[model samples]
Target: MGEPLGFNEYSAGKAIVIELKGRFDASVALPVKNRMRSLLDDTPFIIADLGQISFIDSSGLGALLASLRHASRRGGDLRLANMTEKIQQVFALIRLDHVFKIYPDVKSAVQSLKE
Candidate 1:
Protein backbone atom coordinates (compact mmCIF):
# COMPACT_ATOMS: atom_id res chain seq x y z
CA MET A 1 0.00 0.00 0.00
CA GLY A 2 3.03 2.22 0.44
CA GLU A 3 5.40 3.24 -2.32
CA PRO A 4 6.31 0.23 -4.43
CA LEU A 5 9.86 -1.00 -4.61
CA GLY A 6 12.29 0.28 -7.25
CA PHE A 7 15.06 -1.89 -8.62
CA ASN A 8 18.23 -0.79 -10.36
CA GLU A 9 21.14 -2.97 -11.38
CA TYR A 10 24.79 -2.13 -11.71
CA SER A 11 27.95 -4.09 -12.36
CA ALA A 12 30.96 -3.89 -10.08
CA GLY A 13 33.70 -6.09 -11.42
CA LYS A 14 32.44 -9.56 -10.57
CA ALA A 15 29.74 -8.38 -8.20
CA ILE A 16 26.15 -7.49 -8.98
CA VAL A 17 24.84 -4.34 -7.37
CA ILE A 18 21.11 -3.83 -6.85
CA GLU A 19 19.47 -0.73 -5.46
CA LEU A 20 16.17 -0.95 -3.59
CA LYS A 21 13.74 1.90 -2.97
CA GLY A 22 10.42 2.42 -1.15
CA ARG A 23 8.76 0.62 1.70
CA PHE A 24 10.53 -2.69 2.13
CA ASP A 25 7.90 -4.49 4.11
CA ALA A 26 5.28 -7.21 3.79
CA SER A 27 3.56 -5.40 0.97
CA VAL A 28 6.44 -6.03 -1.42
CA ALA A 29 8.85 -8.52 0.12
CA LEU A 30 7.73 -11.58 -1.79
CA PRO A 31 8.31 -10.18 -5.25
CA VAL A 32 11.68 -8.80 -4.29
CA LYS A 33 12.64 -12.10 -2.69
CA ASN A 34 11.68 -13.95 -5.85
CA ARG A 35 13.79 -11.69 -7.99
CA MET A 36 16.79 -12.02 -5.73
CA ARG A 37 16.36 -15.79 -5.56
CA SER A 38 16.68 -15.90 -9.33
CA LEU A 39 20.06 -14.22 -9.17
CA LEU A 40 21.48 -16.88 -6.86
CA ASP A 41 21.92 -19.35 -9.68
CA ASP A 42 24.43 -17.29 -11.62
CA THR A 43 25.58 -14.29 -9.63
CA PRO A 44 28.33 -14.74 -7.10
CA PHE A 45 28.37 -11.54 -5.08
CA ILE A 46 25.54 -9.06 -4.57
CA ILE A 47 25.26 -5.61 -3.04
CA ALA A 48 21.83 -4.38 -1.97
CA ASP A 49 21.68 -0.58 -1.87
CA LEU A 50 19.09 0.60 0.63
CA GLY A 51 19.41 4.37 0.44
CA GLN A 52 15.83 4.95 -0.61
CA ILE A 53 14.10 2.24 1.38
CA SER A 54 11.81 4.19 3.67
CA PHE A 55 10.75 1.31 5.88
CA ILE A 56 11.04 -2.41 6.61
CA ASP A 57 9.22 -5.18 8.41
CA SER A 58 9.87 -8.77 9.50
CA SER A 59 8.97 -10.02 6.04
CA GLY A 60 11.54 -7.73 4.51
CA LEU A 61 14.16 -9.03 6.90
CA GLY A 62 13.22 -12.56 5.94
CA ALA A 63 13.72 -11.78 2.28
CA LEU A 64 17.24 -10.53 2.89
CA LEU A 65 18.07 -13.52 5.07
CA ALA A 66 16.76 -15.85 2.42
CA SER A 67 18.92 -14.20 -0.22
CA LEU A 68 21.96 -14.42 2.01
CA ARG A 69 21.41 -18.11 2.62
CA HIS A 70 20.88 -18.82 -1.04
CA ALA A 71 24.00 -16.97 -2.03
CA SER A 72 26.09 -18.55 0.72
CA ARG A 73 25.02 -22.01 -0.26
CA ARG A 74 26.56 -21.37 -3.63
CA GLY A 75 29.70 -19.86 -2.10
CA GLY A 76 28.61 -16.28 -2.69
CA ASP A 77 27.32 -13.45 -0.51
CA LEU A 78 24.72 -10.70 -0.34
CA ARG A 79 25.97 -7.45 1.11
CA LEU A 80 24.14 -4.27 2.08
CA ALA A 81 24.88 -0.63 1.32
CA ASN A 82 23.56 2.93 1.50
CA MET A 83 21.20 2.22 4.36
CA THR A 84 19.09 5.13 5.51
CA GLU A 85 19.32 6.02 9.20
CA LYS A 86 15.95 4.47 9.82
CA ILE A 87 16.78 1.24 8.09
CA GLN A 88 20.19 1.17 9.68
CA GLN A 89 18.74 1.48 13.15
CA VAL A 90 16.16 -1.20 12.47
CA PHE A 91 18.91 -3.55 11.40
CA ALA A 92 20.88 -2.75 14.50
CA LEU A 93 17.93 -3.12 16.82
CA ILE A 94 17.34 -6.54 15.34
CA ARG A 95 21.03 -7.38 15.54
CA LEU A 96 20.98 -8.10 11.83
CA ASP A 97 23.62 -5.47 11.28
CA HIS A 98 26.13 -8.07 12.38
CA VAL A 99 24.61 -10.77 10.28
CA PHE A 100 25.16 -8.95 6.99
CA LYS A 101 28.16 -7.13 5.67
CA ILE A 102 27.17 -3.48 5.61
CA TYR A 103 28.86 -0.68 3.69
CA PRO A 104 28.37 3.05 3.64
CA ASP A 105 27.79 3.05 -0.11
CA VAL A 106 27.43 0.86 -3.17
CA LYS A 107 31.00 1.45 -4.24
CA SER A 108 32.28 0.27 -0.88
CA ALA A 109 30.08 -2.80 -0.94
CA VAL A 110 31.36 -3.76 -4.37
CA GLN A 111 34.92 -3.05 -3.41
CA SER A 112 34.72 -5.28 -0.34
CA LEU A 113 33.49 -8.12 -2.48
CA LYS A 114 36.39 -7.69 -4.84
CA GLU A 115 38.79 -7.97 -1.96
Candidate 2:
Protein backbone atom coordinates (compact mmCIF):
# COMPACT_ATOMS: atom_id res chain seq x y z
CA MET A 1 0.00 0.00 0.00
CA GLY A 2 1.75 3.08 -1.26
CA GLU A 3 0.54 6.46 -2.33
CA PRO A 4 -1.06 6.40 -5.72
CA LEU A 5 0.03 8.71 -8.47
CA GLY A 6 -1.85 12.01 -8.71
CA PHE A 7 -2.11 14.75 -11.28
CA ASN A 8 -3.92 18.03 -11.86
CA GLU A 9 -4.56 19.83 -15.10
CA TYR A 10 -5.20 23.53 -15.44
CA SER A 11 -4.93 26.20 -18.03
CA ALA A 12 -2.52 29.12 -17.96
CA GLY A 13 -3.16 31.34 -20.92
CA LYS A 14 -3.17 29.06 -23.96
CA ALA A 15 -1.00 26.39 -22.39
CA ILE A 16 -2.10 23.63 -20.11
CA VAL A 17 -0.12 22.67 -17.03
CA ILE A 18 -0.31 19.12 -15.77
CA GLU A 19 1.01 18.82 -12.25
CA LEU A 20 2.09 15.29 -11.42
CA LYS A 21 2.48 13.94 -7.93
CA GLY A 22 3.51 10.74 -6.17
CA ARG A 23 5.14 7.89 -8.06
CA PHE A 24 4.99 8.03 -11.86
CA ASP A 25 5.60 4.38 -12.64
CA ALA A 26 3.94 1.73 -14.77
CA SER A 27 0.88 1.90 -12.59
CA VAL A 28 0.02 5.39 -13.71
CA ALA A 29 1.74 5.91 -17.01
CA LEU A 30 -0.97 4.85 -19.41
CA PRO A 31 -3.71 6.93 -17.87
CA VAL A 32 -1.51 9.95 -17.76
CA LYS A 33 -0.50 9.37 -21.34
CA ASN A 34 -4.14 9.18 -22.34
CA ARG A 35 -4.92 12.36 -20.50
CA MET A 36 -2.06 14.13 -22.20
CA ARG A 37 -3.22 12.90 -25.57
CA SER A 38 -6.73 14.17 -24.94
CA LEU A 39 -5.51 17.51 -23.73
CA LEU A 40 -3.12 17.97 -26.60
CA ASP A 41 -5.92 17.36 -29.03
CA ASP A 42 -7.42 20.69 -27.98
CA THR A 43 -4.61 22.68 -26.44
CA PRO A 44 -1.68 23.91 -28.40
CA PHE A 45 0.87 23.30 -25.67
CA ILE A 46 1.33 21.36 -22.45
CA ILE A 47 3.73 21.79 -19.59
CA ALA A 48 4.34 18.85 -17.27
CA ASP A 49 4.93 20.24 -13.82
CA LEU A 50 7.14 17.63 -12.18
CA GLY A 51 7.76 19.60 -8.99
CA GLN A 52 5.67 17.15 -7.03
CA ILE A 53 6.71 13.93 -8.73
CA SER A 54 8.81 11.89 -6.33
CA PHE A 55 9.58 8.93 -8.52
CA ILE A 56 9.46 7.77 -12.14
CA ASP A 57 10.26 4.57 -13.97
CA SER A 58 10.98 3.59 -17.55
CA SER A 59 7.31 3.21 -18.34
CA GLY A 60 6.62 6.68 -17.09
CA LEU A 61 9.38 7.98 -19.29
CA GLY A 62 7.90 6.15 -22.24
CA ALA A 63 4.51 7.68 -21.58
CA LEU A 64 6.02 11.14 -21.66
CA LEU A 65 7.77 10.48 -24.94
CA ALA A 66 4.60 9.17 -26.45
CA SER A 67 2.64 12.18 -25.30
CA LEU A 68 5.29 14.48 -26.68
CA ARG A 69 4.97 12.81 -30.03
CA HIS A 70 1.22 13.07 -29.92
CA ALA A 71 1.35 16.76 -29.15
CA SER A 72 3.83 17.31 -31.94
CA ARG A 73 1.54 15.57 -34.37
CA ARG A 74 -1.18 18.03 -33.40
CA GLY A 75 1.14 20.95 -34.07
CA GLY A 76 1.74 21.44 -30.36
CA ASP A 77 4.52 20.53 -27.94
CA LEU A 78 5.18 19.02 -24.56
CA ARG A 79 7.75 20.40 -22.15
CA LEU A 80 8.86 19.69 -18.59
CA ALA A 81 9.54 21.78 -15.53
CA ASN A 82 10.63 21.52 -11.88
CA MET A 83 12.20 18.09 -12.28
CA THR A 84 13.83 16.45 -9.30
CA GLU A 85 17.52 15.67 -9.41
CA LYS A 86 16.87 11.95 -9.69
CA ILE A 87 14.40 12.43 -12.53
CA GLN A 88 16.78 14.81 -14.26
CA GLN A 89 19.52 12.19 -14.01
CA VAL A 90 17.26 9.58 -15.51
CA PHE A 91 16.37 11.85 -18.42
CA ALA A 92 20.01 12.69 -18.91
CA LEU A 93 20.94 9.02 -18.97
CA ILE A 94 18.34 8.34 -21.63
CA ARG A 95 19.29 11.41 -23.67
CA LEU A 96 15.81 12.85 -23.21
CA ASP A 97 17.35 15.88 -21.60
CA HIS A 98 18.37 16.87 -25.08
CA VAL A 99 15.00 16.08 -26.55
CA PHE A 100 12.72 17.88 -24.09
CA LYS A 101 12.71 21.52 -23.20
CA ILE A 102 13.22 21.41 -19.44
CA TYR A 103 13.03 24.41 -17.16
CA PRO A 104 14.07 25.05 -13.60
CA ASP A 105 10.65 26.43 -12.76
CA VAL A 106 7.12 26.34 -14.08
CA LYS A 107 7.01 30.04 -14.80
CA SER A 108 10.03 29.80 -17.05
CA ALA A 109 8.62 26.83 -18.88
CA VAL A 110 5.33 28.63 -19.45
CA GLN A 111 7.19 31.69 -20.63
CA SER A 112 9.12 29.64 -23.12
CA LEU A 113 5.90 28.20 -24.40
CA LYS A 114 4.38 31.65 -24.78
CA GLU A 115 7.34 32.79 -26.81
Candidate 3:
Protein backbone atom coordinates (compact mmCIF):
# COMPACT_ATOMS: atom_id res chain seq x y z
CA MET A 1 0.00 0.00 0.00
CA GLY A 2 1.09 3.55 -0.59
CA GLU A 3 1.69 6.05 2.16
CA PRO A 4 -1.38 7.78 3.51
CA LEU A 5 -2.22 11.02 1.79
CA GLY A 6 -2.45 14.18 3.86
CA PHE A 7 -5.01 16.92 3.46
CA ASN A 8 -5.45 20.17 5.32
CA GLU A 9 -8.17 22.73 4.96
CA TYR A 10 -8.16 26.47 5.54
CA SER A 11 -10.97 28.88 5.05
CA ALA A 12 -10.13 32.13 3.30
CA GLY A 13 -13.24 34.14 3.95
CA LYS A 14 -15.89 32.25 1.97
CA ALA A 15 -13.50 30.09 -0.01
CA ILE A 16 -12.24 26.76 1.26
CA VAL A 17 -8.62 25.96 0.49
CA ILE A 18 -7.69 22.31 0.58
CA GLU A 19 -3.99 21.55 0.62
CA LEU A 20 -3.12 18.10 -0.67
CA LYS A 21 0.16 16.40 0.10
CA GLY A 22 1.71 12.98 -0.54
CA ARG A 23 1.00 10.66 -3.40
CA PHE A 24 -2.52 10.45 -4.75
CA ASP A 25 -3.32 7.13 -6.37
CA ALA A 26 -5.99 4.45 -6.39
CA SER A 27 -5.62 3.56 -2.74
CA VAL A 28 -6.31 7.07 -1.53
CA ALA A 29 -8.76 8.26 -4.14
CA LEU A 30 -11.86 7.18 -2.23
CA PRO A 31 -10.78 8.93 0.93
CA VAL A 32 -9.96 12.09 -0.97
CA LYS A 33 -13.31 11.96 -2.71
CA ASN A 34 -15.21 11.51 0.53
CA ARG A 35 -13.42 14.34 2.28
CA MET A 36 -13.94 16.70 -0.64
CA ARG A 37 -17.59 15.69 -0.92
CA SER A 38 -18.17 16.50 2.73
CA LEU A 39 -16.48 19.87 2.41
CA LEU A 40 -18.45 20.84 -0.67
CA ASP A 41 -21.71 20.25 1.13
CA ASP A 42 -21.37 23.59 2.89
CA THR A 43 -18.83 25.55 0.91
CA PRO A 44 -19.71 27.29 -2.31
CA PHE A 45 -16.14 27.54 -3.54
CA ILE A 46 -13.18 25.19 -3.31
CA ILE A 47 -9.59 25.52 -4.35
CA ALA A 48 -7.47 22.38 -4.36
CA ASP A 49 -3.87 23.26 -3.60
CA LEU A 50 -1.51 20.77 -5.17
CA GLY A 51 1.81 22.40 -4.31
CA GLN A 52 2.85 19.51 -2.09
CA ILE A 53 1.32 16.69 -4.05
CA SER A 54 4.31 14.57 -4.99
CA PHE A 55 2.65 12.17 -7.32
CA ILE A 56 -0.60 11.37 -9.09
CA ASP A 57 -2.12 8.68 -11.25
CA SER A 58 -5.28 8.05 -13.23
CA SER A 59 -7.36 7.51 -10.11
CA GLY A 60 -6.16 10.80 -8.70
CA LEU A 61 -7.12 12.62 -11.83
CA GLY A 62 -10.51 10.93 -11.79
CA ALA A 63 -11.12 12.06 -8.24
CA LEU A 64 -10.38 15.66 -9.22
CA LEU A 65 -12.69 15.50 -12.21
CA ALA A 66 -15.43 14.02 -10.06
CA SER A 67 -15.02 16.77 -7.52
CA LEU A 68 -15.24 19.40 -10.24
CA ARG A 69 -18.44 17.90 -11.53
CA HIS A 70 -19.97 17.58 -8.10
CA ALA A 71 -19.17 21.19 -7.20
CA SER A 72 -20.48 22.51 -10.50
CA ARG A 73 -23.76 20.61 -10.23
CA ARG A 74 -24.41 22.23 -6.88
CA GLY A 75 -23.81 25.74 -8.26
CA GLY A 76 -20.41 25.87 -6.64
CA ASP A 77 -17.02 25.84 -8.33
CA LEU A 78 -13.79 23.86 -8.06
CA ARG A 79 -10.38 24.93 -9.25
CA LEU A 80 -6.87 23.50 -9.15
CA ALA A 81 -3.81 25.43 -8.06
CA ASN A 82 -0.07 24.91 -7.70
CA MET A 83 -0.05 21.68 -9.63
CA THR A 84 3.35 20.13 -9.91
CA GLU A 85 4.87 19.74 -13.34
CA LYS A 86 4.09 16.03 -13.38
CA ILE A 87 0.44 16.51 -12.62
CA GLN A 88 0.25 19.45 -15.01
CA GLN A 89 1.61 17.25 -17.76
CA VAL A 90 -1.04 14.68 -17.11
CA PHE A 91 -3.73 17.30 -17.32
CA ALA A 92 -2.32 18.58 -20.56
CA LEU A 93 -1.99 15.11 -22.02
CA ILE A 94 -5.55 14.29 -21.15
CA ARG A 95 -6.82 17.67 -22.38
CA LEU A 96 -8.20 18.36 -18.92
CA ASP A 97 -6.11 21.48 -18.67
CA HIS A 98 -8.60 23.21 -20.89
CA VAL A 99 -11.60 21.72 -19.19
CA PHE A 100 -10.91 22.90 -15.65
CA LYS A 101 -10.02 26.34 -14.41
CA ILE A 102 -6.42 26.27 -13.26
CA TYR A 103 -4.44 28.95 -11.48
CA PRO A 104 -0.79 29.49 -10.71
CA ASP A 105 -1.55 29.71 -6.99
CA VAL A 106 -4.30 29.33 -4.46
CA LYS A 107 -5.07 33.01 -4.22
CA SER A 108 -5.64 33.36 -7.93
CA ALA A 109 -7.75 30.25 -8.14
CA VAL A 110 -9.96 31.36 -5.29
CA GLN A 111 -10.30 34.83 -6.72
CA SER A 112 -11.29 33.44 -10.09
CA LEU A 113 -14.12 31.51 -8.46
CA LYS A 114 -15.56 34.71 -7.06
CA GLU A 115 -15.72 36.32 -10.52
Candidate 4:
Protein backbone atom coordinates (compact mmCIF):
# COMPACT_ATOMS: atom_id res chain seq x y z
CA MET A 1 0.00 0.00 0.00
CA GLY A 2 2.93 2.30 0.53
CA GLU A 3 4.32 1.76 -2.91
CA PRO A 4 3.31 4.32 -5.48
CA LEU A 5 2.31 3.42 -9.00
CA GLY A 6 4.72 5.13 -11.34
CA PHE A 7 5.72 5.09 -14.98
CA ASN A 8 8.63 6.11 -17.12
CA GLU A 9 8.17 7.34 -20.65
CA TYR A 10 10.28 6.58 -23.65
CA SER A 11 9.94 6.78 -27.40
CA ALA A 12 10.03 3.86 -29.81
CA GLY A 13 9.61 5.26 -33.28
CA LYS A 14 6.04 6.50 -33.47
CA ALA A 15 5.08 4.68 -30.29
CA ILE A 16 5.46 5.78 -26.70
CA VAL A 17 6.62 3.28 -24.11
CA ILE A 18 5.37 3.63 -20.57
CA GLU A 19 7.24 1.47 -18.09
CA LEU A 20 5.03 0.89 -15.09
CA LYS A 21 5.95 0.16 -11.47
CA GLY A 22 4.11 -0.76 -8.25
CA ARG A 23 0.48 -1.80 -7.86
CA PHE A 24 -2.26 -0.61 -10.16
CA ASP A 25 -5.36 -0.21 -8.05
CA ALA A 26 -8.05 2.35 -7.26
CA SER A 27 -5.58 4.68 -5.58
CA VAL A 28 -3.38 4.98 -8.62
CA ALA A 29 -5.75 4.43 -11.52
CA LEU A 30 -6.87 8.02 -11.86
CA PRO A 31 -3.35 9.41 -11.88
CA VAL A 32 -2.24 6.88 -14.43
CA LYS A 33 -5.27 7.67 -16.60
CA ASN A 34 -4.53 11.37 -16.55
CA ARG A 35 -0.88 10.84 -17.33
CA MET A 36 -1.72 8.54 -20.23
CA ARG A 37 -4.31 10.97 -21.55
CA SER A 38 -1.64 13.61 -21.71
CA LEU A 39 0.54 11.38 -23.82
CA LEU A 40 -2.21 10.52 -26.33
CA ASP A 41 -1.98 13.98 -27.79
CA ASP A 42 1.56 13.29 -28.91
CA THR A 43 1.53 9.72 -30.23
CA PRO A 44 -0.97 7.26 -31.59
CA PHE A 45 0.90 4.20 -30.35
CA ILE A 46 1.15 3.51 -26.63
CA ILE A 47 2.94 0.60 -25.00
CA ALA A 48 2.14 -0.06 -21.37
CA ASP A 49 4.98 -1.99 -19.75
CA LEU A 50 3.67 -3.80 -16.73
CA GLY A 51 6.85 -5.60 -15.79
CA GLN A 52 6.85 -4.26 -12.27
CA ILE A 53 3.17 -4.26 -11.57
CA SER A 54 2.48 -6.55 -8.62
CA PHE A 55 -1.29 -6.20 -8.55
CA ILE A 56 -4.25 -4.86 -10.47
CA ASP A 57 -7.84 -4.68 -9.35
CA SER A 58 -11.12 -3.87 -11.09
CA SER A 59 -10.38 -0.14 -10.97
CA GLY A 60 -7.04 -0.65 -12.66
CA LEU A 61 -8.67 -2.80 -15.29
CA GLY A 62 -11.27 -0.12 -15.85
CA ALA A 63 -8.56 2.47 -16.33
CA LEU A 64 -6.85 0.27 -18.89
CA LEU A 65 -10.11 -0.19 -20.80
CA ALA A 66 -10.71 3.51 -20.68
CA SER A 67 -7.24 4.18 -22.06
CA LEU A 68 -7.86 1.68 -24.86
CA ARG A 69 -11.14 3.32 -25.80
CA HIS A 70 -9.54 6.73 -25.70
CA ALA A 71 -6.71 5.64 -27.91
CA SER A 72 -9.05 3.94 -30.36
CA ARG A 73 -11.11 7.06 -30.70
CA ARG A 74 -7.99 8.96 -31.64
CA GLY A 75 -6.86 6.39 -34.18
CA GLY A 76 -4.27 5.09 -31.69
CA ASP A 77 -3.82 1.85 -29.79
CA LEU A 78 -2.84 0.76 -26.27
CA ARG A 79 -0.94 -2.50 -25.89
CA LEU A 80 0.19 -4.30 -22.76
CA ALA A 81 3.68 -5.67 -22.13
CA ASN A 82 5.40 -7.82 -19.55
CA MET A 83 2.28 -8.77 -17.68
CA THR A 84 2.77 -10.47 -14.32
CA GLU A 85 1.08 -13.81 -13.60
CA LYS A 86 -1.53 -12.18 -11.43
CA ILE A 87 -2.46 -9.59 -13.99
CA GLN A 88 -2.46 -12.17 -16.75
CA GLN A 89 -4.88 -14.33 -14.80
CA VAL A 90 -7.20 -11.40 -14.30
CA PHE A 91 -7.17 -10.72 -18.00
CA ALA A 92 -7.93 -14.35 -18.77
CA LEU A 93 -10.70 -14.56 -16.19
CA ILE A 94 -12.34 -11.45 -17.60
CA ARG A 95 -11.67 -12.59 -21.17
CA LEU A 96 -9.74 -9.40 -21.83
CA ASP A 97 -6.58 -11.21 -22.86
CA HIS A 98 -8.04 -11.57 -26.33
CA VAL A 99 -9.18 -8.00 -26.41
CA PHE A 100 -5.71 -6.51 -25.90
CA LYS A 101 -2.42 -6.92 -27.67
CA ILE A 102 0.01 -8.59 -25.27
CA TYR A 103 3.77 -8.77 -25.61
CA PRO A 104 6.64 -10.22 -23.64
CA ASP A 105 8.31 -6.86 -23.28
CA VAL A 106 8.12 -3.22 -24.26
CA LYS A 107 10.36 -3.56 -27.31
CA SER A 108 8.27 -6.42 -28.62
CA ALA A 109 5.09 -4.55 -27.99
CA VAL A 110 6.41 -1.56 -29.89
CA GLN A 111 7.61 -3.71 -32.72
CA SER A 112 4.31 -5.55 -32.95
CA LEU A 113 2.37 -2.33 -33.09
CA LYS A 114 4.54 -1.06 -35.91
CA GLU A 115 3.64 -4.04 -38.05
> Which structure among the candidates has the greatest TM-score?
2
lDDT of 3 at 106: 91
Residue range 1-115, candidate 4, lDDT tens digits: 5377888999987788998898899999998998888999898779999989888888888888999999999999999999989789998988899989999888788778758
Q: Model 3 Cα displacement at 52 (Å)?
A: 0.5
lDDT score, candidate 4, position 114: 56
Order of candidate numbers by lDDT, starting with the best: 2, 4, 3, 1
What are the lDDT figures for the candidates, one per model? Answer: 0.87, 0.90, 0.87, 0.88
Say what the RMSD of model 2 is: 1.4
In candidate 3 the C-alpha lDDT for residue 62 amounts to: 93
lDDT by residue (24-110, candidate 3, tens digit) is 989999899888899999896789999888888889999999999999998987888999798899888889999888999998886
Q: For candidate 2, give the lDDT of residue 33.
A: 95
Comparing 2 with 3 on TM-score, the higher-scoring candidate is 2
Residue 76 C-alpha lDDT in model 2: 87
Worst 10 residues of 1 by lDDT: 1-10
Give each model a TM-score: 0.94, 0.95, 0.92, 0.94
Error of 2 at 77 (Å): 0.4
**Which residue pairs collide, candidate 1?**
none
Checking candidate 3 for backbone clashes, the offending pairs are none
